[model samples]
Target: MYAVFKRELMGLLNSLMAYITIGVFLLATGLLLWFFPDTSILEYGYAELTGFFSLAPFLFMFLIPAITMRSFAEERREGTYVLLAIRPVTDWQIILAKYFACLVLVVFALIPTLIYYYTIYQLGLPQGNIDGGAVTGSYIGLLLLGSAFVAVGIFTSSLSKNQVVAFALSVFICFIAYSGFDAVSQLFVLSYFETVFLSLSVNEHYQSISRGVLDTRDLIYFITFVALFLIATKAVTGGRKW
Candidate 1:
């Protein structure tokens, strides 16, 4: 698993895809937080990244899929799935190794954002009046959200041999999972079910946790969501042998 993880990580660095994804993330966030005049982070006097955090999950609708689209799709396209199938590793190991590698890449991409925190710290009126709890909570929420998206991307990548299709499907699925429930909640026909629907929406739970509240229900929801997708991916891969 570690070998597979290292190989996958190294492969990402060798391609332009990783660079482009990271660059785009930084560029988009930087522009919103620093460059843009009206809604810039500086203009809001937000020592934390509430604005940036709010925009990240939406931006990741494209970025996470771009990073994960080729995970297994490219392998299958290259006719290497058969070769990988015969390896000593179990199918779950292979899937998880690849998933972990993608998660590592996502985490690495987020590391640079810490500089924004430091910058805000230095610029704050009290030289650090920032809400540390809120910032920490936001970062945790981002990781949970990104992990769920990564799992969704991996499952979609496992379903097809074409990377482009994988990317599109992954993005669509992530967007739906992230926001579909809230949309359902707004339907007049589902008025009675609004509470349940809203409870299921990823954005709802993310917002709760991002406020630094640390709700157990929200944490459980994210954990369950990730596990469900990972298990689904395992089942899909296992079916290949039958």
Candidate 2:
């Protein structure tokens, strides 16, 4: 597992697309949080990073998929997937190793956003009056949310041999999981089920924990979401591989 993890992570780091994906993520976030006049920090007139958190999810919708689209898709494309299946590693180990590689890249992309946090912390009237709890909570929430995205991406990647299809499918599926429940909650016909629907959505659970209060339910929800996809990927591949 560690060997697969190292190889997967190194492969991404060595690729030009990986750098471009991370670059675009950082650039987009930088523009929105600091340079762009509309949602810029200057316009918010506050020492909070709410806007940054708000925009990150949308950015991740594509950036993460781009990173993970090639995980299994490329292997199948190059006719190496069968060889991978016969390796000494368990299917879960392979899936998890690739998943963690993408997660690390997503985390790498997010690390630069700390500059936004520092800037807000220093720009406060009291020069560090920022809510440390909320900042920490938001970052943690983002990491978990990103991890979920990586899992979704890997699942989609495992489903197809075409990287483009993998990317598109991953993006659509991730978006639905992230926001579909809230949409269902708005339907009056499903009003009775609204609570349950909202509970299943990543956005709602993310907002719950991102508020600086860690809820056990929210943590379980994310972990289960990730585990489900990882297990599903293993099951799907095991069926065909064996």
Residue lDDT tens for model 1, 185-223: 888454669988888899999999889889999999999
What is the Cα-based lDDT of residue 120 in candidate 1?
Answer: 92
- After the best TM-score superposition of candidate 2, give how far the Cα of residue 226 lies from its true spot, in angstroms: 0.7
Q: How well does model 2 score by local distance difference test?
A: 0.91
Badly placed stretches (over 4 Å) of model 1 are 188-191
**Among all windows of ten consecutive residues in candidate 1, which has the lowest summed lDDT?**
183-192
| lDDT scores of the candidates, listed in order | 0.89, 0.91
How many backbone clashes does every candidate have? Answer: 0, 0
Clashing pairs in 2: none
lDDT score for residue 136 of model 1: 91
- For residues 1-242, write the lDDT of model 2, one tens digit per residue: 99999999999999999999999999898888888889999887989999999999989999999999999999988988788778899888888889999999988898888988888888999999799998899999999999999999999898999999999998998899988878888884556688878888999988988899999999999999999999888877777785
User: Which ranges of candidate 2 are over 4 A from the true structure?
Assistant: none
Q: How close is candidate 1 to the true structure, as a TM-score?
A: 0.95
